[model samples]
Target: MRTAIVVGAGIGGVATALGLGRAGWQVTVLERAPQLGEVGAGISVWPSAVKALQQLGVTGLEKASVVSAPAGMRRPNGQWVVKASALGLELPVMVHRAQLHELITSGFGSGVTVRTGVTVDGFADGAVRAGGEELRADLVVAADGLRSVVRDALYPRYAGPRYSGYAAYRGIADVELEDGGGETWGRGRRFGFARLIDGRYYWYATENRAAGAVGDVWSAFDQWHDPIPELLEATKPEAVLQNDIYDLPLPLVPFAQANVALLGDAAHAMTPNLGRGACTAMEDAAALVRHVTGPAAIPAALTSYDAERRPVATKLVRVSRNVGRVGQLDGRIAAAVRDGLLLTGGKVAGLLARRRSG
Candidate 1:
């Protein structure tokens, strides 16, 4: 029986392990965290990732997540800027990041060993060095996220993850809002609120701030009208998760050596502009499962996986960066343009609607 080792045990790593285990490979997952959990507040799962869930026999995202088509943007006042019907194939769903992680981790059973608190430092041809142990495997998956150990050692020339010059503040609150999803744009910033799986409202705000800076979620956003203040006030300070958005430059070696491949943020780290980060990782895992299922040589399987994933991930990295510019638009002129776009009815939806179509 062929053995595969996956590093990280994150959404990407767990998904890859489940896919490979189901395809009859012995799998071992290494996670550095003491406990397998995520602190991120909320994530939007788009159709591309939903397809991956369906492929893995996962269903009822509405049960595990909050399902609401984005109701479009509005001003700080109670005026509608834009409205949109669910145009895409799958209605966008938002869920707590930890819940989604739990769903992915639950799929692993026998033949899938999960090791928490173990860090993978580097990898050679067909083996990984983790916790001073040299573990050999037929396949090594570098799904270790933005700071991928394998990526750093294997593709040194490839630029590492860079900050996108914006910080996001996210939290889930007990504010009693309507059961729909809504986003309101302010000067150089955006706030999104949605219902969660547990009947609570998940609220998030992004602003152009210094990398790694903790934001004043309430004081900074208090000027906004309506539920913004209420939601922020209702949210406990401890519940907020602050993140500095980061992304990797593209066109590097998505695959390395004969027995190693990269997946998810390890391969193409991108901003959460369209919430496609996890989705693309799921696609990579699925494509890998398909390619390696046949009796093809290890190199051939890796080639096929890279062929299917590189172009898409590259495009996403670039697209997410561009979208970040739009969402993080600053200055007087840019804010006016953003407010105007949201103020119009169909015009705002017409232009911004296609952004998530990918």
Candidate 2:
């Protein structure tokens, strides 16, 4: 049987290993951490990603579990900018990050082996050196995340992560919310919330700040609408997760080189504006598994995976970065112009939806 080694045991890495195992490849998962788990508050799984997981042998997600996109965009003052129903946007199922990770990892089959505390140091043709030992396989998959050592080593000259001139704060809040939550956009900052399946709110906020600058982020939204402040109040200060936003530069380098393939943030980390980062990574794994399990040779399979995922991921990265730029517009005049355009666009979209439904 063909064998594969997947570096990193995060959501994307585990998903890749599970898919390869289901596809009949013996997979060894290398996790640098002492144990297997995921950090973060909540994750938004889009429909396509859900199907991709199912294709990878994941189950238990009912069609009904998909929720409406947050009720649309709002102003920091709670005024409506555009209702989600108006935009007729595709919705995603919100889940706790750890829960989603567990769900994907649960699909691991007997052909799969996991090695924690195995910090991958470097790699060569179909082999990887980790923790003072070298292991060889038919294929090597690098899913080591944004600061991927494999990625860095492979393309030492590759211009890596480009900061998005802002930072994001995310948390799960236990506060009660009557209405479906949505995003509140303001000048140079924004706040969004969504109800998770477990009866809690998954909220995220962004603001323009110098990289690595930390302070009371809540102060910006404190005087905003009801429940905005309450959500923060309910979340413990330390529990709120924050990260400076970043995405790989456009025309992302190819996903495959020799017998190795890069997956997830290692390949296409993007700003969170579109909420498609993790979902895209899962899709990449599915594509890799599909081609590998097909009649094509492994080399051809890697080429197909690269061809299929790179273009799509490139487009998403571009659009998501553009959205962040527009969403974080500064200055009163700029925001007013943005709100006007959005309101007008919302009306047009709502009318289109109404016409279709009618």
Candidate 3:
């Protein structure tokens, strides 16, 4: 059996290990964390990610996810900017990040070996140096996240992730909303909330701020709307997770070199504007499994994986950055123009749909 070593046990890494194990490869997953887990925020798993999970034989995720109601952009004062019902948009299902991580980790099925607290020091000569030992494998799948050591080793000349000039705070609140939640936009900031499967509310806020700046999320968004303040109030101060948003530069870094492959953020980390980072990572896991499972050689399979995934991941990275720039407009005139265009565009699209139906 082909031997594979997967670094980092994030959602992508664990999923990749499961996929390779199912493909009859002996897989070992090395996670630096003491235990495999995820943060407390909720994840919006779109239809594409759901299908990818199904393809990987991970079941029960759908049962644990809540299909989102029609949601759309809103003004800071609670007026609808672009109603989802009018636009006829499909929303993604919301699942708690921890629950989703548990689901994926549980799918390992004894075929994959997981070693926690193993820090990979370096990758050289097709072998990984970790825990004072050099381990070689037929394939090395790097899913070590945005600050990936493997990526640094591969492209030393390339500067790493750039800050997106915004910081994000995410939390899950033990509160329920009568109306299904959506995002509210303001100058230089935005807040989004959604109901999770377990009845708690998941909300995130972004502000145009310097990296490592500390501020009060509740004070920033207290006057936005009914549930926005309520959600913030319900969430404990300690539960709020904050991070500066960062993404890789355009003309994305290559994802494959020889028998090694980069997965998820390790390959193309992006802003969360499109909510496609984790979704695309899941897609990457499935795609890697598809190309590497056949009778083809390991190097050829990695080449195919790189060829197919690079374009899609890079496109999303660009799109997500653009979306963030537009949504985070700070000037009054620019914000007005953006809001007007969104409203007008939504109305025109709705009219066109009605005309087609008529």
Candidate 4:
């Protein structure tokens, strides 16, 4: 059996290991963390990602997820810019990030092994030095996050992740809401809330801020709509997690080199404007497995994976950046123009749908 070593045990790494194991390859996953887990938050698993999970033999997500009500854009004062009914797009199922992590970790069978607390020092000649041992494999899949050591090692000259001029705060509250919840956009800031499967509410806020800046989360959205304040009040101070948003630069470095392949954020980190970051990573896991299965050779499989995933992921990165820039408009005139355009676009779309139906 072909042997593979996967670095990092995030969702993408674990999923890749499962895929390779199912493809008759012996796989070992190395994670630097002492244990495999995720910080608290909720993720929207879109239709495409759901399909990818199925392809990787992961199940039970449907039972564990809350089918989201249609969502729309709103102003800070709770007036709807576009109603949920007007969206006309299939809504994603909301699942807790930790729940999904546990589900994926539990799917590993006999063909795959995961070792945590193993720090990878370096890679050479198809071998990775970790835990004072040299381990070689037929393939090395780098699923390490945004600051991927493997990626840096391969392409030292490539510029890495760049800040998106915004910081994000996320938390889950134990309160329930009647409406599944939606996003509220304001000048240079936004807040969104959604129901979680566990009878809790997941909320996220973003604002233009310097890196490592600290302030009160409540103060940030104190003037927003009703539920926004309520949710913040319900959240414990320590539960709110903050981080600066960052994405890989355009004209991406090749995702694969020789037998080493970069996956997830390591390959194509993007702004979370579309909530497609994790979905795209799941897509990568599926595509990597598909191209690597029945492989003519390891290098050829890596080449095929690169060819199939790079173009799509690169496009999404650019699209997401553009969306972030538009969403973070701070100027009063610019915000007005944006809001008008959104209202107009929604009306036009609604009109087109009505005409087609009639």
The C-alpha TM-scores of every prediction are 0.91, 0.97, 0.98, 0.97
Candidate 2: residue pairs that collide: none
TM-score of 3: 0.98
Poorest lDDT segment (10 consecutive residues) of candidate 1? 82-91
Candidate 3: what lDDT? 0.90
- lDDT of candidates 1 onward, in order: 0.80, 0.88, 0.90, 0.90
Off by over 4 Å in 3: 355-358
As for candidate 4, its clashing pairs are none
Task: Estimate, for each residue in 223-337, the C-alpha lDDT of model 2 and write its tens digit.
Answer: 9898899999989988989889989997898898877889999999999999999999999989988888888877788888999999999999999999999999989999999
In model 3, the clashing pairs are none
Off by over 4 Å in 1: 59-62, 86-90, 341-345, 348-358
Compare candidates 1 and 4 on TM-score and give the better one: 4
lDDT for each residue of candidate 4 in 176-241, tens digit (9 for 90 to 100)? 678669999999999999998888999999999887788577998998988899999899989899
Q: lDDT score of model 1?
A: 0.80
In the order shown, the candidates' Cα RMSDs to the true structure are 3.3, 1.5, 1.1, 1.2
Report residue 137 deviation for candidate 3 (angstroms). 0.6
- Decide which is better by lDDT, 2 or 4: 4
Candidate 3 deviates by what RMSD? 1.1
